[model samples]
Target: MERDSTAGGAEDLLLEDTVSKLRAGSLHKHELAEAMEVEQEGLVEHQPLEQDDLNFEKWKPKPKPKRTLHEKIDDLKTYLWNAETKEFMGRSGKSWSLILLFYSALYIFLAAMFAGCMCCLMWSISPYAPTYNDRVMPPGMTMFPHVDVAHGFDVAFNASDRSSWRKYAKALEAHLKSYDDGVQDRRNINCEGNTYFMQDDLEESAERKACQFKRSWLGECSGMKDKDFGYSKGKPCILVKMNRILGYLPGQGTPVHVTCGVKKGSTEGLGEVQFFPENIFNLRYYPYYGKLRHVNYSSPLVAVHFPSVPYDTQLHIQCKLNGRGIINDSPTDRFLGSVSFTLQVGA
Candidate 1:
């Protein structure tokens, strides 16, 4: 019976130890559960705070640094000629060279086209003849010793002053120098005065023959006999010439004649008018070819002499070309077929 009691006591002690170990295990599990719940709560709160910080950082703008003048100059220099990229004005050297070559070729093409057009224009036109002659039709008339005034040329001079008339005489002398007999005979032919000398053929030098107008034909007005041209004696000589028209003929049947008279309401009369070599332009000089064809052609001249112009008085004189085709009455063209001048002589 004593042995059975001892075994039962040992069993009771072993059962108590097992129960204590189970209770301790239960407490550890409960504490671990509570710690896990607190940790989950802390993670949720930290996640929202971290998200707010991320949003603030995303919306905030970065501040720009202020650059000094030297820094700005360096930036400009880099833009103009970048040492790092080897670029000039935002373009590489090779790129600029290609662009330059393209523009150069385009300009060269344009210049060549322009030159070709000019060459074609030059080839199309002749150098000897004019392309247009509309403005030069019918021709015009002019005079030498052409002193201009309000109404017309004023051939006024004091007879007592040699200087006053000397220039007029000199002008006449110079005008007649080309008409010298020796000079005319050398370069021109004495063609028939009443008919036209039409030359369709060109000479060996490719020129048409010109007519001779002798200086002696001017007679007293010629500078050979009277060097002063009567200016010192209060009488003056005036020369009249008609402008040449290319391929134009004047005076169909009758020869073109010049007639000088005192204009109406003249204060003084034009006294004792005389014309040298007659008042007509001989038909031989008509139908003038161009300057290239008629190289030595000299236009015929008619010299008018005023022997007794009233002294100390002004006289209005008009010289008109009387011809069928001439338009002398046109008020619009005062210088077409006529030339008028004022003459005043002082004793």
Candidate 2:
């Protein structure tokens, strides 16, 4: 059966306006039936479009400002400067804060040089450096300081000690004994039947004898150099330092040997041998600290007795090494103290 939808709806109550229009004969029946078969929901309202609103001008956006090269450079500089400041200031110092760097460096360098010099002064370079090369000791016996072979240095083995003189005395004695053994053979020497060798009594004394300076230390540990044949004005001296420790015999005319111990030491850049005085009282045939020096131990000493003692008379002593020639006429050195003794008379 074909049913009409508006047939059961009340007029002016719930019926659609289309139905009302059809009942009033204003709507056509075929249109109403067609409308009933289709959707009869609420109207789909749409706003009317304005003519101006529909107008579409060409779409365009404003141009942005571009940064200049100089601006970029400025920004980079600021960033770098800030970074550097933060790094350096954190340490409470600046990268260029080493203000006295040059002076500090110089101070360290000089200090090192001074230390090196001191070390050299205290040590030797070699043990057999020829000290008497080209130059010979004077005719008499005398002393020549430890010589540096490469440079022809004739000076003592850096004798810088003045406190204990005798501590090195035994070594001096041993060195002399060795030198004697090396230079001359004491083998097969005939000291025939009960032949007792006697020392010169002139060298005998009841008490120990020592050499001491009157008021000053006798040029102790003097740093001198090898000069003309003798100690003119420029030469090194190995002045003995004496005190109670040294065998100082407080009498007149005591025979004493000042054995200078050649203390051995080494250093860098030097090629020389150094020795101390094993020669006492011209122990060798040379001068000790004066000119035209000669060694005495290997030479002869002529002794004479004087009836009259020279008051505060100064006597100079020197010597030569075992294997060298020297002179006794070196006139530069003089006694370092007051005269308290004289040579014994020889028969």
Total clashing residue pairs per candidate? Answer: 0, 70
As a whole number from 0 to 100, the lDDT of residue 35 in candidate 2 is 83
- The clash tally of candidate 2 reads 70
Off by over 4 Å in 2: 1-99, 117-135, 141-301, 305-347
Candidate 1 residue 47 Cα shift, in angstroms, is: 39
Q: What lDDT tens digits, residue by residue, belong to model 2 across residues 1-347? A: 22344555445355577677667775476678778665544232345656876766633465778989999997777655556556432332454356457678989999999999988965754322333344322222222222234632223221233222222233323333423432433321212222112222422222211111111111111221221111222122332321111111211122233322112222221222122322223221111221111112122222111122222222232222222221222345222221111111111
- The lDDT for every candidate, in the order shown, is 0.84, 0.30
Residues 38-105, candidate 1, lDDT per residue (tens digit)?
Answer: 99999888875556666776787988999999999999999999988999999999999999999999
- Look at candidate 2 and tell me the lDDT of residue 45: 33
TM-score, model 1 to reference: 0.71
